[model samples]
Target: IEHSIYQIMKEDSLLYCLPKEPLQQAFRTNKLSVQGTVYGYVGWIFCQHFLERLGKEYLFLIHILDRRNPVGEEVLEKLKKRLHQDTFTREYILDIRKQYPSLLKVLYAHFLTGHYVNQAEASNQPTISYKRLTAMERLPGEDLAKRIKEVTTNYHERLVFEGFLCFNKHVLKTNLYQTTKVALSIRMDPSFLDEIEYPRDPYGLFLVYGSEFRRFHIRFSDVCRGGIRWIRSREREGQSINVR
Candidate 1:
């Protein structure tokens, strides 16, 4: 089956709420790593029935925050507080974070972290991951070690890489899950590698859906590459950024 990234996204319309400038600014600046993450944020904002809609406002704050580029400690704190209070309702953001950790990380970290405040405080904990060789190699613009670091550092690592996870509706006699690794190609540019890198960013989207069969988690990152049309392309053989 074939799916259009633009068409599928428009279904709920994550961008529908935000004014055009901030939406484009987000893509340019690489805010909220995954499209689905943005989608979830938007959905939570709409919070239908009992929910309050604040996604648009959250996006607006991000844009204004970028534009104002506040300097003073007091001013920054006040703006931050205003943003926290007006845009992201604490309960909703926390709930969404549990559901979409990576997206939230991208969004929060973008606004909060600026150069090293204290070098000694940086994380030193070891990462648990291993690399796998693939028949498919890196695309023209990507580096191998860089690619590994990108996938390993992301939210999916612990969930799928540590243990294969898939949401199956039926209970299995045993918790059976099939696993495989594909060095899937990823975007390095907005035009796309070979073509245009659709929505180019260091982190790509990886979506998991209910399925009878298990799939590599990295494959779900985006429809353009992960989607069926990508699999059908003959040129698609040598461009995965994954080790599995």
Candidate 2:
């Protein structure tokens, strides 16, 4: 079943949202560290496309934030079955509270510390360090240590690594610029685009929307230094509409 789905994705040229020249150039240059935050079915579509194009030589890492919710659990189960068959792919379910306790503590403290007068003042404000917060929380029940060891032990030093992360929903605080080289945000409804602020400094941003025509449209925007350069648009029929 997964193989059939993968073949469908590979054969569907319309699913390739990125510009041909740029994508080819990225692969040719061996800049293969690609990551995104997945929300739902559209996210899965993009992941399949990436894996099909990147081939089985690249390592694919999937991070899941929630495993208890039924919808998320279903997605995880499907991903496990799909990814397990691929020898190079790996999946990690991150317990945020356990994985990032100190970071969370600092964030909590920062929010509770009080409001600053301005951006400059906020930068200079003295606050309690994360080290003084508490001890590092261990990840229990899951063999995260063994997974990490396996990743390190079997990892090739020269092979490029690619990663994918599925979040229950989009969070305003996610630092996409620092974590992912290219970030793809999926929105099933196009109406919400007006309310969201685009990221200022990501190498690439693919805003995917489900149109009323029952077609998926991708708006490619290159963001750098607080400016956006419209690249191109891709329609569900494999048509390239130049937006710039």
Candidate 3:
């Protein structure tokens, strides 16, 4: 009886939420007003029904986290060091090590060494070029490591790392609204945003829950690239329009 019960529980655990057909259709057509199989409302309704079948205990499966915080430089350094020393399976390690090539011998060595020398020349640094074939000439893995060490030791690189860290954290959160909000916040970067142009519209809504039955107005600009006025109606002809 115990073994049979365990099998039943395991089978139940295998059940997964079905793909929201309406949401998939919206992405396919890039339109919001489609009904019947295309209406996301039906998918949402089905989700509510599924949740009821699972009972209130199913709420424990939800994950909660704030994802905007950036990881420190110390954290990145530690992770990099750990990754460099990683030794799990021999096959995986060999696959990665094969990606790095040491400076070759003979004429090939001189040719490959010039690639690095040319970079120094472009940067106005003292340059070395070899025209002769020699077996001794080789750039060690340490040379590549040194170059990366110098490249990443900068304020701009640190800023970019911070942005990447925040993005990674946001992806782990796995909530649609939180992911969108974090991405919108990061787009405020001036370096790239200034050269690009985009439209704006005022889109707003509120998600209400809990005992107080309170209201929280949400501004689309706060959670998206800009305000986009979605012209939604029961009529088929209505198309979404927006202001810039």
Per-prediction TM-score: 0.18, 0.21, 0.15
What range of 10 consecutive residues in model 1 has the weakest lDDT sum?
Answer: 127-136
- Tens-digit lDDT track of model 2 for 152-224: 3233211211112211122223221121223333332222231112233333334442211122333445333
> What do the candidate models score in CA lDDT, each in turn?
0.29, 0.29, 0.27
Q: Tens digits of per-residue lDDT for model 3 on 39-120?
A: 1222222122111122122222211212232444445445433432342222332222222212112212322343222222
Best by TM-score: 2
Q: How big is the positional error of residue 176 in model 2, measured in Å on the Cα after superposition? A: 14
Identify the superior model by TM-score, candidate 1 or candidate 3.
1
Judged by lDDT against the true structure, how good is candidate 1? 0.29
For candidate 1, give the lDDT of residue 14: 30
Tens digit of lDDT per residue, candidate 1, span 73-120? 455456544543554443534343354344333322322222112111
* TM-score result, candidate 2: 0.21
For model 3 the local lDDT of residue 243 reads 9
Off by over 4 Å in 1: 1-25, 31-34, 43-244
